[model samples]
Target: MNETPQKSQELKKVAECLYRNGNKVYFALVKVRGKQIKRSLKTDDMAIAKRRLAELREKAERLHGKENKNIRFEELAENWMESIKASLKPKSHDRRRVAIVGLTPFFKGMPVKAVGFAEIDEWRRKRGASISARSHNIELETLKNLLRYACDRGILMDNRAEDFKRRKQPKAVVDVLTRPQFQVLVKALYASPIAVASGAAAMVEFLAYSGMRVGEAREVRFCDVNFETNTILITSGESGTKNHEERTIPLFPNLRNLIQRIKAARPTADANDRIFQIDSPRGALPAACKRAGLPHFSVHSLRHFFASNAIENDVNFKVVAGWLGHSDGGMLVAKTYGHLRQEFSATMAQKMTFEGLSDTPPTFAVVRDAAA
Candidate 1:
């Protein structure tokens, strides 16, 4: 009789029960109606676990009920985020996680079925007012992906977020540093006593010449360099690449010289060790720009400078695209750098010359005599 009473008391306080499984703690023994329920609260904090217990119980009540009115946008998003985290790189995972933060304030506790196209459109309109169209599109895309995941998992009848229109993004103007500006920036990097002596100038020059993204530059290893071929092998490192492809780029003279000096500084450095292990020269770069009185540009602008310069130098479009690791076979290069190509072509036209051409075409009489 006493044992039966104890069992009844335990069941009555189901939400307070907890258990540990391996290193992870879970809220266990939750019962709703005739069913038992357990869930991973995903944390060990007692306060957090208590809070989550209430939410879980509410979730169970709705899931078990005939009305099924408690399924929430936050719940679906949490499930979706967990499913995709393993497949994404750390940086990408963080980006998706950040997108959800903005979404949660408005939609977190709302039912999935309750959210409609108009609500999403209104959110897009309001979000676009403060952020760039590209940034707004990313947030919108994240919301759509979450809803689609819910539909795929049978949590929603359909994904209404998919019907929402994406904000139209304007064509971005590509800004590049001219040679004089690049020289000034380089001078600034080295002029600072704080700048690392291990090829800071070379690093800047390499990006300007090689068209390598900053991340790609940081991942470069000494073994990737081929002194004989005058080329550096570009590979998708552990983080993967922007397009998940690999290609080669010419190791320009200044970059090669700087790399040699860096290698000499670390004579025992392993071939697998990164050639230049530096973070974005954000501090040094911007400070240098300020001192030089040049307009601010990002590290990526160096790559644009390389591409623009290559186009102006009449490098074949296909060749330039390949060197830049673009898989589109130069279509994107043509779109972004076509105007530079036109400028170069016009400049070339002014100097056009023929080695073997008469000052004037043969007269019609001379042509008739030859025919006769």
Candidate 2:
């Protein structure tokens, strides 16, 4: 039964200094430094509620005379950002900083301990109106992490932000190119009058063949290639890969041939010289797609094409994930390309049939005659 506002606000004593509201959610109502403090345990489970209530009481007693209780949300957030800055990549740090900046206005002057579900809900309602769900979720996560940090430091009793659910995000559609479509695109790129078309064509082919991200491809040098071992070392500039580790992918046949062709054109090129001169094929790619009479394919589309082709060719997901610099032991690969694998499986299934099912099946006439 739904409780009226008056009934829901009424607290029933459950145990010493612990109470359950009409809705059955437990709360801690305790006194600290001669002042009454009320905090929700944020759970209905009896055991969990009791434990959280005990923890809350202990925190109040321990921080009775401390100045940590007075720390503002802005100060806590700044401290959290500073603590994480050294551990995160520059781009990642910047993203988190942006999230915190978006959150600062609503939470600025409030004490860490004073912020609760109402404040968080209000922030979510206001923010959801202006930004995409994905962006709001990022800021929401940042808020939760900041509160978690405050809890660890005893500046706040519990992370109230955890109780709020994140907004739903739209599923991403994976778009890739078939071999014929890719071939036509490359051909059009090569035939284009644009001066950078040739280089752009080379970049497209390199990404599709090597599964290297645009960033990683930009940093590849001729010296990184080992023709003897048929491997190409992928070092994405000083920052390394997205995961900050260098990986070596097999010098695939097409990739090797592409390199050799480029090498032939520039015999005097230094070993340190990068294979592709252009930073990105953005302009060239769209132009080539238009010329080829195909839909526009981004640089990332080439990466997806590589993964789709690998799955179609029966390459193991773990190996593909390794080549793509994923550390999750193929879980991400399976999630993204499992449908492609299913389509490939369906195609392969058509080749299987009972030998006797054919209209011109081989007869056992000799054996039957002998038996007769």
Instruction: Find the candidate with the highest TM-score and give its number.
Output: 2
Tens-digit per-residue lDDT, 223-320, candidate 2: 99999999999998786789989999999999999999989988999999998888888888887888789997899999999999999999999999
Q: What TM-scores do the predictions have?
A: 0.72, 0.79
Instruction: Report the C-alpha displacement of residue 320, candidate 1, in angstroms.
Output: 2.6
Q: Model 2: how far is 54 from its true place, Å?
A: 6.8
Clashing pairs in 1: none
Worst 10 residues of 1 by lDDT: 7-16
Report the C-alpha displacement of residue 11, candidate 2, in angstroms: 11
Worst ten in a row by lDDT for model 2 = 363-372
RMSD of each: 16.3, 5.9
The TM-score that candidate 2 achieves is 0.79
Q: Clash pairs of candidate 2?
A: none
